[model samples]
Target: MRIGVPKEIKIHESRVGLTPATVRELIANGHQVMVQENAGLPIDLGNDKYREAGAQIVDTPEEIFAQADLIVKVKEPQKSEIPLLREGQVIFTYLHLAPDPIQAKGLLNSGCIAIAYETVTDKSGGLPLLAPMSEVAGRMSIQAGAHALELNQGGRGILLGGVSGVPPAQVVVIGGGVVGTNAARIAMGMEAHVTLLEKSIPRLQQLDSLYGSRLNTIFSTTDALEEYVTTADLIIGSVLIPGGAAPKLVNREMVSRMKRGSVLVDVAIDQGGCFETSKPTTLADPIFTVDEVVHYCVSNMPGAVARTSTFALNNATLPFVLALANKGYRRALTDDQYFRDGLNVYRGHLTHAAVARDLGITHTDALNALI
Candidate 1:
């Protein structure tokens, strides 16, 4: 199989789909890998590195997409790349189709196999591919929140870990999954008062037992969230419902309840955000003020640190990329239930229910495709 890795063209996106090491491994597995020139440049990986990995370096994304059997990418395909897709070709990437209608239309018309990393599930019901980036984004949420808390940044001018004679700032994290857990951990590490909210009683009990007196867990409700935000200095929205639009737990009316200049970091922005007023921002202009409350809703938060994100994302996606490339997506998915769940679109049909419901499209069983 011929696999291609294109340089990410999304505005301000720097992470590459495949790392040089992963390229080397794909070649070792008897697959031909094509990497566009400077594809890994944003991640500080040089053309010589890919060349040395026994991979061919192409000059343009057009060439890579036109010729490769499988296209591995770090983000969803942009508009320009849409027409370049060929029918029956395999595209493996983080296709956040739930919130993206335009891209969904193009992929469907192109008649290609689109497997989304965010939808893939593990035996334990964990999102395997989205986990690495979620962890990265979660940790960065607090880091960004901390920066946004600075007075110079139009924040409340409160320090997360307050000095002696002053109380530490309070942090409220929505959700208790990978993103929330990681955010809570970082906030706790900063010596801030952390409150984690979740709808799952089991998860709440688990977090409570795990953190003991160091953290506080709350059962999520409208009244509950409203009450917490009233005094929160940093609100981390890490809620994710998976393959669906994230519920807006924080509404515009509730925004007024937050302390003036407090920061709201929506880590779930990729899934359309859990805050009613949250809109996607870029790393270049990462934050914006809404009614005096700062909103950090950069959907690709992990892209800010491309090198680490590239390596970490590649580690989680490489095995599956190899799986689909070696045996073909249909055969490989037919053999692995986890991989099948990853199938969002196959040959123009919506195979993932979340994406289908999201776009109001029809859901086709992935197993039926094998026949």
Candidate 2:
């Protein structure tokens, strides 16, 4: 199998799909790996490192996309790259299709087999490939929100961890999943008044056991959301629905009623967003004001910490990458139901149900598409 790693082209995105160590492992297993020139250079994983690991350094993304059987990438294929896709070629990356109709249409028209890293599952029902980035984004949400809360950043000029006589900022996290948990943990650690809302009673109970009195865990509801959202100084939107679009828990009306200078960090922006006013922002220009409330919705939050994020992502994705290279996508996907969940598009057919439903497109089961 010939595998290709292209330099991520998204604005402010610097993570490479494969690390040098992982490339070496693939080469040792008899797979040929082609890396775009300087794909990992910005992160200090230079071309020489890949060359020493037995990878062929290509000069352009065209060479890689044209020749490689499997194209590995960090972010979704951009509009320009979409035209390079060929029938039956495999594209493995984070394809957030629910919110982006343009990308979805491009993939459907390309006739390529697309697997989304964010939707891949583990036996524990956890998104193994998405976890590391989610963890990074979750932690960074607090950091970004804190920075955005300053008066210069179009925020309320409130400090998250206030001084002796001043009260700390009120932090609200919507969801109790990986992103939400990490966000809440960091907020609490900063001495902010943290409140977490979760729809699952079992999950809420679990969080309660974990944090006890240190955190406030509330049942997620319309009233609960409105109550907390209105008073929150920093509202972190961490809700997710797997391959589906994130539910808009914070409506425009709710956002309009928020206190002036309140900050919203939507970690769920990749899957649309939990906040109604949220729009994907780049790291270069990460925040926008909506109804006087600051919205920090950088879609690729983990990309801001590219080096750590790349290594962490490579650690989780390498095993699955090996499986696909070794047995081919069909066998690798068919053999593992959890892995099959990653197949969002198969030769132009939408293979993931949640993505299909959310996009209002025809759906095909991954196994059926494999046939």
Candidate 3:
């Protein structure tokens, strides 16, 4: 098998798909790995490092896309790269297709087998591949929100943790999943007043047990959201619905009532955002004001911390990458039901039910599509 790694072309995206260590492992497993020139250079993993790892360094994305059987990437294939895809070629990456019909249509027309990292599940029903990046984005939400709250940044100018005489800022985290949990933990660590709203009682109880008196765990309700959101100094929207678009929990009216200097950090922006006014922003220009509230909705928050993100992602995706390489996509996916859940598109067919339903495309069973 020939695997290709292309340098990410998204604005301010510096994360590479494969590291030198992962390339070396693929080579040792009898697979040929082609890496675009300087693909890892942004993260300090130079071409020399890839060369020493026995990877063929290609000068352009065209060469790798044209020759490699499997395309490994950190982000979704951009509009320009979509034309490079060939029939039956395998694309393994984070394909947030539900919200981006253009990308989905392109991939479907290209007749490529698309496996999304974000939808891949583990035996514990956890999103193993998406977990590492989620952890990173979750923690960074607070940091970004804090900065956005500064007066110069167009925020309310409230400090996250107040001084000895002042009261701390109110931080509200929506959702109790990986992203929300980490956000609450970091907010609490900063000595701010934190409230986490969750839809799951058991999960809330679990969080309550973990944080004890340090964090406020509330059962999510319309009224709860209305009350907390309007009063929060910094709000983190970390809601997710797997491969589907994130629910718009915060409406435009809710946002209008927020404090003038308040900040909103939507970690779920990659899945179309949980805020009604949310639009994808780049790290280059990460914030926009909606109803006087600053919104930090950068679609790729983890990309800002590329080095750590690449290594952490590699740790979770290596095994699955090797499986696809050694056993081929069919055998590897058929052998593991959890892994089969990652199959979003298979040679022109939409195979993931949630993504298909959300995108209003016809669904095909992954197993049937494999045949």
Worst 10 residues of 3 by lDDT: 154-163
Clash pairs, model 3 backbone: 156-261
Local accuracy of candidate 3 as per-residue lDDT tens digits, 297-320: 999999999999999999999999
Question: lDDT tens digits, residues 338-361, model 1?
Answer: 888988887888888877897898
The runs of at least 3 residues in candidate 1 whose Cα sits more than 4 Å from the true structure, single-residue gaps closed, are none
> What shift in Å separates residue 164 of candidate 2 from its native position after superposition?
0.7
Write one digit per residue (lDDT tens) for candidate 2, span 227-279.
99999999999998999999988999999999999999999999999888999
Alpha-carbon lDDT of model 3: 0.97
The best candidate by lDDT is 3
Best by TM-score: 3
Relative to the unseen true structure, what is the C-alpha lDDT of residue 274 in candidate 1, on a scale of 0 to 100?
Answer: 89
Model 3, C-alpha of 368: deviation from truth (Å): 0.8
Model 1, residue 106: displacement in angstroms? Answer: 0.4
lDDT of 3 at 40: 91
TM-scores for every predicted model? 0.98, 0.99, 0.99
